[model samples]
Target: MPAHDPQATPADELSQARRLLNRVFGYDDFRHHQGEIISTLLAGGDALVLMPTGGGKSLCYQLPALLREGVGVVVSPLIALMQDQVDALRQLGLRAAFLNSTLDAETVHATEQALLRGELDLLYVAPERLLGERMLSLLERARIALFAIDEAHCVSQWGHDFRREYQQLSVLHQRFPAVPRIALTATADQRTRQEIIDQLQLQEAAVFVNSFDRPNIRYTISDAPNPRERLWRFLEQEHPRDAGIVYCLSRKKVESVAEWLTARGREALPYHAGLSDGLRRHHQQRFLREEGLIVVATIAFGMGIDKPDVRFVAHLNLPKSLEAYYQETGRAGRDGLPADAWLAYGLQDVITLRQMTQDTDATEDFKRSAHQKLEAMLGLCELTSCRRQALLAYFGETLEAPCGNCDNCLQPPQTWDATEAARKALSCVYRSGQRFGVNYVIELLTGKDDERIRRNGHHRLSTFGIGRELNAVEWRVLFRQLLAQGYLDTDLEGHGTLRLTARARLLLRGEIELHLRRLRRPERGARERRGRTVLALGEAEQALFEALRSRRRALAEAQGVPPYIIFHDSTLAEMAQRRPTSLGEMAGIPGIGETKLNRFGKAFIEVIREHPG
Candidate 1:
């Protein structure tokens, strides 16, 4: 552990932090608000930090834990995340340990003893564990640096991923008022942010608001006529053999997707709340340690996962809210590299979500707020402008200029005059008695005469067969846009029936011009084009990169750790290109700090020296 000098100048503290940043985390500088957040906490002040997942949220707390005298108590929420973090910190030669439900009795006792002995620099525990009498008693005896509340959004009941244990975290301030506290999360909108400040009792904390934009993740939303096929197409085109997550809305769907991908020769696993604890841990561990393993899961899966090189995040169904969507997508491109965020949605997504929200047992106000978030997500999917701009705006940040990395920016969709189409669709809903769902109404318009349609004697209606110009898929897009744009609403009491609102009158009477993006289903066997690739190197350097990766895989397998824990792919790519021949030069490269230089530096240098490329 590095010693902190009480007589040290402020310059010395800053220099020490930079030295640790390079020596431990393998970075030369702090990213975004990390430096300021760390300094504020180290100065015995409280802080609320809103950084993106890949934006170095952990470093802000971890660096301070090293700079200050005592162990930084990080109140994490998940077991897998705690293990991933502790493993990474240990690899960096830091004294890090964790206490959670997964640990056995002996191990827990040993870890507690270490905390009291002041042998550990950083200690991670779940909120429930931290609030326990035993753990609190142990912490009380130790000289504490600060309390880092990771995933602080879990404290907000309004968030999609709220946890009851997180609300109890305020007791840390009540018990240890002199110790500084830092609450951190990667996902929180304006309201949820305020809710976190309130719930965590951090009213005096300085707020560090990092822009929520993940510039490396390219966003794409497709109409799902056949989501299974669409997902395959996305994989074959955008991310073949890449490590990613395929998000589903249900546990059953998660299982099926995992099975389907595994059968197709892809490394895949399923994770959800319905699975056994052992199975969940196994799948989660495999995802962290194994490269190119896809974890098909519901929202139950991610929130504190520290795997840095996840190449993509695909959504087979719409998430519950925009906040959820943002957090999930932010999981990709965490290595400061290019990645993809893909989704396939149709009319069913909107209806199913609306129905699910209506059926929820939460308060009416909570349901309404959740519905608004869903609407915001729908707007992002149907948006014609910059997706990044709208995504940031939801979190109370604005983009002065458009980002050119999203699908809309790359291949802009064509807008069509849907005024006549909107009138026909609205009239069909009215003439069909405004009681049927989207599919039933769409059938009458597209002229698919089902038994129910014929039984209701709706074939003779004037609105029937008027929507021949648009297919069922296209019509679904229109209706979904209408619902999203306030022209229609779902009657929750009537079992997901579609109803026209007063706003629908404008489109019905030609008072407003309706224009919608004409969605195009990709041609069969057509590949989706990707944006710029990450860590681009020459062909000769590519060979060296592969060799470095092969060696990294072997080292990781032997150590029972993730490959990125040794060194991220970005660092390897830099080594491949620069081809440093000596230890002195290797030490100067980014990500190769003194600890790593002493440990694996010689072996990597040997690889580079022998490679003929």
Candidate 2:
């Protein structure tokens, strides 16, 4: 080993980070990868940071821009991101500006002049803006200190948000050979990571991969008959009167859902590309400014948004890929507070996602890549193990036990022998000439005498009536398991045909044993009963928690914001558990700070003492 540097210490590193934090945004500590990533950039090295949302990635670049001598050029993909960051920097008294298509020519010219005058510390520009020869020459003329790429995963073809303009970002190094570069993204798998590095030409960059684990988030996947009903129930019970985003797969679904909520007397809005830009901006602003505003949208929303108090994010359909799923779910619980990350999954979600993936006209490599991602997401949905552990493992991390937060961890499921069900489903698919959809095959297997079944004569097949032991719902569940287990494949070209794979043959021949888990169905009565019983808490603790929440609500009202904006539900739960008696003890809670302690410390102590232990 080389000789150690006796002069360097962890204290020195921390002190440097604290100073930078205070100087730039008036903070005192780093969140997630902000410290290491900033240090790497300041040392004149490139970095690849894979942090979750609410992990303070902007600070990684902002602090380095303040520490460096010249201006830091930030290449962002969204104009809204530029405006938000610029406004926030101005609030902090930092000289920052942006150049984008949204700006008028005069404003753009003024921004360039400020850059050349060395009056601005950081300048944000879109990738397309940076590609212009005029902008390139302006950058060359300015004293460049650093080059930062935000949302760098967009450079990869495998990324869900791939943009062709991102391919030109590599020119930054050739044009400004001495500027330190850093590529940042909240979500990227191993494949996308390599593509980002290659496309950005950061071969020699120091990699600072942070943990993708969001332990504060609780992941739950529910298999219900009516997904929409289940989603409404979940929202009403867990996160009533909170701001959230619900993602539907199509624009039509977005509109209908938003209208449905509106009819039900909820303050919800529809958002998608089909709407006018003015309408989209209006809905986006309402969601940000108003509490309990639900925005139902397609995947076009929620990129680089600074909303930290999003209490939940629901997916009405499966996302395009696991990376997309991760990135979208990351929009929740960004303040290191407890938040719910939920998905109402079913058989149709799998079919819809797979069909969408196959319908795209891409190279064979891209199709196979997408297929692998879908398989991973499918496994996540159908997993009988811990959801948090499975999610973390996909990102190259390990969790040895249940996280004690998710649904599965709270109420474990039972496994059964699925080998027979798998065989019957596969047999029905094969006997039906692999030409029918899941519903038809399911009816055939259950020996239903429906018109379509008799018209197709599927009831006369050898596999028909063999599966009469199970009901229609049971057969549907079995088919979903078969799809998740790879025993069957859906033919996307023929209106989502159910086809048996080779694995199905082995099951039929008794050469392979398939194991399936028994899924629990929440009946209306049972769900209603569960809903009536509020969150489980002791009498004293419940009182204290309620009191703390009341105080939180008062403070939030005083500030004209939502209660969650002050402290998340998870933080309240922690306070209830600790029953902190002093300011120091209260400040030691996860999200409580000195400012908040000064504001609400006495109230919290009074609440805790008013109840019996």
Number of the predicted model whose lDDT against the real structure is largest: 1
* Clashing pairs in model 2, backbone N/Cα/C closer than 3 A: none
lDDT of each: 0.86, 0.79
Model 1 lDDT tens row, 303-363? 8888888989999999888889988988898988889899888777887887777887889
- Candidate 2 Cα errors over 4 Å, as ranges: 1-16, 23-26, 31-33, 523-613
Q: What overall lDDT, based on C-alpha atoms, would model 2 receive against the true structure?
A: 0.79
Cα RMSD (angstroms) for every candidate in the order listed: 1.8, 5.5
In candidate 1, which residue ranges exceed 4 Å CA deviation?
448-451, 523-533
Clashes of 1: 0
TM-scores, one per candidate: 0.97, 0.85
